[model samples]
Target chain A: MTSVEHSPLTRKLSAFVALTKAELAVLDRLHKRRRIFRAGHDMVHQGQSAQTAFILYEGWVCSYKLQADGTRQIVDVQVPGDFLGLRSVLLRTSDHSFEPIVDIEAVEVRASDLLEAFAQTPRLATAILWAASRDEAMVVEHLVGIGRRDADVRMAHFLLELGARLALVGMGRAEGFDCPLTQYHLADTLGLSAVHVNRTLRQLRERGLVTFRDGHVRFHDHQGLVDLAEFDPAYLDQTGPLLT
Target chain B: MTSVEHSPLTRKLSAFVALTKAELAVLDRLHKRRRIFRAGHDMVHQGQSAQTAFILYEGWVCSYKLQADGTRQIVDVQVPGDFLGLRSVLLRTSDHSFEPIVDIEAVEVRASDLLEAFAQTPRLATAILWAASRDEAMVVEHLVGIGRRDADVRMAHFLLELGARLALVGMGRAEGFDCPLTQYHLADTLGLSAVHVNRTLRQLRERGLVTFRDGHVRFHDHQGLVDLAEFDPAYLDQTGPLLT
Candidate 1:
């Protein structure tokens, strides 16, 4: 396997702990075996015993549960640098299905190998645990979005969150991010109908707060959006010192 | 500090990993300093620098975020053995407020002391991580409830979930559990109006599916309720081997 000079895992881990060269080498080796999946591919299915955890090297993946009424609720959106199945590694089964919204490049790390790595490298383990906690924080934030916020505020909050997460990996600018998700995905995520999502998007565009076109979202007034959504980035835990 | 015979923290940790007598002794010692909080008291407030984590030894607590519009979203319902502020310990601030739902007995473990414990006992650390992951899983499940399910299904699902969780700690019976939350809390949790929640509860009661009286819920048909909610316990991760 050809080694990449820099990986998103390295960038993400560095945010939690200053990885030594040796630590980086171990991460690089773990992520060397990359696999690509096309859009709409179910990378992991619910109830399946998950044996491997994937590191999203590129593109978007979403974890969602399909309800009895046939509607889906996306639990988490995975971007580059996100570990897809860290919790599954401990839980042993996938509680939700993971699928790619776009063509995705991911590196598969066997559960045994990851556990071994965690045992051998405490710093790396701390980073992984930090990542897991951050994921829980994000889920809680999203719960607030769906449970308390209205459609307009939910859309604003969702876009601002996506932009912030993307900016962490140097993918998006302060004002915008590449958003490949359609109105259907937004509907599922925000607990609104697709029609409602479309109307809300139009309202946001008319207000000059946000604009989505050509698979990208541009925030005309980032602060305006933030204010409308009551968005706070502190929950993301990005500004903290390295745990180690 | 008074030493107790057994603690919910020990029971919860033992589910994740087999605790040696020494580890159990440490946990018992950590939980010796019990604190009491009255109903409606905030255990940990949002935006506050959380210096400690609490183990819910008795009664109920909830972590919630208050919206700008004066509404609230209950992010998680904490039961006995639930670890609050584990994430806050890493993030340096509480992302959500934790409040007691009833007069509560809790063990306050300082964040620094918990970290020291983790450093000394990797097994204990792993158990905490498992607990965090379980919390995330519950949040994700609640997301699905609010995002996709109707009010009736949501209520059923919530009740069934509460029952299962309570049963884990030997609190609830097979058919029902003690439900101290009012319709207002249920409305907040399910993203419905209080009136709607009350009406739905009436409907469920009239249908002979469930009955709530004197702060206790009795399910006439557990399987019937589960079917309506499409509730699956696999997401709870109860069957997994302890992570020793």
Candidate 2:
């Protein structure tokens, strides 16, 4: 494997690990069983016995749990390099569902394959665990947003964090990023009503912080939003491979 | 190591792993460096560089993040079997603070020791990872409760989940358990005010479902509370070690 084989997973992991050539070869093999899933449909459902995990390479997906009242709470959105259903694969069941927001390209990773890979490559396993920790950190941050922060700050923080994550994989920037999510998605993700999401976005736009329209999230005042949300990237920042 | 040497951690991990005597010996090594932390003080603070983690052997602690407005959200409560600061230690920093609700007994585990332990005992590593997944699952459930469920259901679900976790370590039961948390802690945890928590408890008690008074939670109608909260223990249930 060479530089030509560099991928979002490789790139993200590289931020933490100085991967060897052999490591790259193993990672490339893991990416072999690629598949495409359609938009607006579930790729995995809550409570299903999970046999295979996924490494998302392209497009967006939202992991959510449906309630008896017909409402859903989007736990986290998956972009390129995110491993869908990986956490619960070892646990034997999926606690939530993953719905592709658009056509998605992902590699299916069986449990045995993943375990074998972990056995063969300790550094790569560490990097993967590091990524999982980041995912959990994002969820913790989301918990803080919903439990403590106000609606406007929560919305701002959510957009800013999304941009930061997308930036990791070269899909976004601090200024703005193209987003396929609608206000309804925002409402579900932020624990706000559809009307409240609309008003919150309007308020943010008026304050020159950010705008969520035209299928894009435009950050008019990136620093302002960060200040308003008290957004910190320290948790998401992995300086180098600590495993060494 | 044998059944006589079993501790809370051994008990919790045993649910997911048939740990060998050799593995149990290594797990016991991790139980060294035990310390006692006083109540009403933080053992780990947010944003601090974390070098070591702890295995809670006894007592309770709350992990929380403070907002700029002098408000804090209790992310999760740690019981006897909980692993405090374990998640963020490898990541290099603590994102939340752990304050003991009562005097706590814990065993300090350094990063090097934990990594070495993992290398020496892969099965125990897998079991530890399984426990971490269970912790993340609880956080996800908490997210759902805050994002979707009403105040009453959220409190009921929160208490029931706490009972379930404590029961795993032989500290709680279906009827009730002693709790050290105050109304302020409940307010922070449930994303409600003290007034709201008081009212919610009163309502539950009036309906003969539960009571939170005199530092104890008495479940008068356990089944009724479970039904009201739509509580599911499947996520927390691990029949046996999947690693083997």
lDDT of each: 0.80, 0.85
Give the runs in model 1 whose Cα sits over 4 Å from its true position. A1-6, A20-26, A240-244, B1-6, B22-33, B240-244
Leading candidate by TM-score? 2
Q: lDDT of model 1 at residue B175?
A: 73
lDDT of 2 by residue, A55-170 (tens): 89989999999999999999999999889987666677888899999999988888777666666666666667667777878898999999888999899889988998888888
Which candidate leads in DockQ? 2
What are the per-model DockQ values? 0.54, 0.56
lDDT tens digits by residue: candidate 2, B77-135 = 99987899886666778888999999999888887786677667655665676787788
**Share of reference contacts kept by candidate 2:** 0.41
Model 1: per-residue Cα lDDT over B1-244, one tens digit each: 3554356666666666778776776676677577899999898899888757888889988888998888899887888888877777666678889989999998878755665565556566666767788788889988887777788998999899888878767788997888788877888788899899889989999988999778999999888898888888876666534565
Steric clash pairs (candidate 2):
none
Interface RMSD (C-alpha) of each candidate?
1.9, 1.6
Clashing pairs in 1: none
